[model samples]
Target: MERAFVVLGAIFGVAGTAAAAAASHITGAGSGLDTAANFLLFHAPALIGIALLVKTGTVHANIGRFGGLLVLVGVALFSGQLALRALADASLFPMAAPAGGTTLMIGWLLVGLAALVGPRRV
Candidate 1:
């Protein structure tokens, strides 16, 4: 689980940087890839931190795992849909991006809650 989070973070970070570059150079303004890249970039470090916190007992394992799952799914859906639309002119679904965004918000809240309520080492 920890490895998964780190790998996901790396993947997202790489893809986000590439997408940002493409958006700037190839797509220009209004391509919408900028938003997707921003989400990926922002969440990359967060996902990694979640893994570390959980591993270190700063967050409950179960809650952290679940939150991380949601975060992964949320990123995939949100960024996937937007990138698909912008680059391939396709849609994952009608409301997939919005749903993903909401999921991300909920997952983040859960992660915070886990930290506050969990039993942590002194």
Candidate 2:
């Protein structure tokens, strides 16, 4: 689990850095790719790392587990949906992005809940 978190953190760090660089290369206001990629490539990894911390039994607590899962799902939807929309220029459901945003908010709330629950002792 610790290894997994490490891998996820590394992946996010690289992707986020690359995306930030790519965003700078764009001349205009924005393509939205950078914004979308930032969330996916950066936050996704951070959240995954948090989940890894929880899963490794370091933060063993039901709230933490639930929060981790929520954040993971939220990141997946938030980032994945945006990437799909931008890269494919497809939007079957107009409400997709909004839904993703909502999921992200909920994920943050879950994390808060976990913090309230506090960490379990090893």
Candidate 3:
């Protein structure tokens, strides 16, 4: 699970950076692509941190893993929708963006919960 988080984080970082570069080249800065890129960039480190914390006992392992999964899935859905919309002018689905955004928030909330609760004592 730690490795999964790290790998997903790395993927998100690379994809976000690439998308950001592409977004900058687009005429309108407010394009969905730009927003998606920013989200990916912002969440990437968080996912990585979750992995680190889980490994180090800073965060509850089970909770952090589940939360990290949500983050990863959310980014994939949200960014996937935006990128498709901006580039191809198509929707991944009717409400993929909103759903993804919601998922992302829920994941963050769980991460926060993990932090608040603290790790289980050895």
Which candidate number has the best TM-score? Answer: 1
Clashing pairs in 3: none
Each model's lDDT: 0.89, 0.61, 0.88
Q: Using TM-score as the measure, what is the rank order of every candidate, best first?
A: 1, 3, 2
Question: In model 1, what lDDT does residue 42 have?
Answer: 93
Candidate 1: pairs in clash: none
lDDT of 1: 0.89
What TM-scores do the predictions have? 0.93, 0.66, 0.93
Best by lDDT: 1
Q: What's the best-to-worst order under lDDT?
A: 1, 3, 2
Residue pairs that clash (backbone atoms under 3 angstroms), model 2 = none
lDDT of 1 by residue, 1-122 (tens): 98899999999999999989989998876888988999899999988999998889888888888888899889989998888889999999999999998998888888888887895545
The worst-scoring run of ten residues by lDDT in candidate 1 lies at: 113-122
